[model samples]
Each structure stands twice: as C-alpha cells, then as structure tokens.
Target: MPQPAGFAFLERDGVVVITHHGRTATTLRGARAADFLEDVEDGDAQEIMARLTGNYRRGNERQARNHPRNKGR
Candidate 1:
C-alpha cells in the first residue's frame, strides 16, 4: 500500500511542526514531543499522526470558544 511521504520535523521558536510532502500537517510543542512520540510510535504513521493532532484539534476547538471573536457566540 502507498504511504505518506517522509515527514519533516522542525522547530521554529518553540513549536515542532510535522509536515508531509512539504506541507505542515501538525505541530507539537518541543516539551511534549518525547513522551508523546514514545507513546504513539508503534502505530502506523498516519494513525500516529492522527493521534498526535487529534488532541490538538479538540484543544483548538475548546480554545476557539474563548477567543475574543468567538466569545459570547
């Protein structure tokens, strides 16, 4: 089966970005990366990526509700 292209791991300022085919698909903070990666490494790359970013998505949604533009909506 085909698979995702190699991912690039980059840190600019403090965030670590994971990209495939040169497109950023997700990010994790440098501090959380080690333990988070260790916990998810056994899964397929796509699944592992989804697990990593899934929490980010949920967190973003929760945070968006608090954003000034979204507040009281």
Candidate 2:
C-alpha cells in the first residue's frame, strides 16, 4: 500500500496535536503523548498517525470484495 501523506504532529506543553491536511484529527495527552513520541522515533510516523486518526486501511479490501458472499455485488 502507498504510504499515507499529509499527516503531521506538534508537541507542546505535554500535549501532542495530530493533523491531517491542515485539520486537527486527534490530540494526545500524558501517557498517550509520551508513547506516541516514542513510537514515532522508532517507526514510520505517517503510518502511526494514520492509524491513530482512523484513516488507515485494514489490508482486507480485496479479500472482502472477492469473497463468495460479495462476489456479485
């Protein structure tokens, strides 16, 4: 899958503000903010942000579409 774009994060005063395409998607505070900072330092920030904002795919779209029950739809 293509990497997600337009996701950004800003940290301030123990808060993490996440945005997509210039709009706020979610805000992380306290332990959540700390964990997010740690994860971003160790992995793909874009993927992480996309997942946090409920914007990432579940990797089953093609399988669902091809299932016998959905084949004709």
Candidate 3:
C-alpha cells in the first residue's frame, strides 16, 4: 500500500481540525482532540490522521476486486 500524504492538522482553542488535500475532513474537540494530539505525538501522524478521517485502505480491495463472484463486471 502507498503511504498517505497531504494530511495536515491544526489545533486551536481545544479544537483540532484535520484536513486532507487542503480540504476539511473532520474536526476533533475536547477529549478527542487531546487524544488525537497524544496519538500524533506517539506514532505516525499521517497514518493516524488517515485512519481517523476514514481515508486509509483496508488492504482488501485487490482481493475483493479479483474474487470469482466479482469477475467480469
């Protein structure tokens, strides 16, 4: 799988705004924002942000697309 890019975040006044490709994708606030900040600091920020925004692939698309039932679409 390819690495996720173009994911950025901004935190202000206890609000966390997550953007993908320069557009707003999700906003985290309160406890969620705090948790996100911690996670970003602890691990890969791009992966975390992609997962939080539901933008990461589940690694099943290729198999699903090649399944017998899905053949000859």
Instruction: Please give each candidate's TM-score.
Output: 0.39, 0.72, 0.74
* Model 1: per-residue Cα lDDT over 1-73, one tens digit each: 4654455566666666777657676878767766555654665656566556553332377778888998779
Model 2 agreement with the true structure over 1-73: per-residue lDDT tens digits: 8889999999999999999888888999999999999999999999999988894445699989999999779
| Residue 27 shift from truth in candidate 3, angstroms | 0.2
Off by over 4 Å in 2: 56-73
**Residues 3-50, model 3: lDDT tens digits:** 988999999999999998788889999999999999999999999999
Stretch of 10 with least lDDT, candidate 1: 50-59
C-alpha lDDT score of every prediction, in listed order: 0.63, 0.91, 0.92
**How well does candidate 3 score on lDDT at residue 44?**
99
Q: What is candidate 1's TM-score against the reference?
A: 0.39
lDDT of 3: 0.92
Task: Report how far off residue 18 is in candidate 3 (Å).
Answer: 0.3
| Global fold similarity of model 3 (TM-score) | 0.74
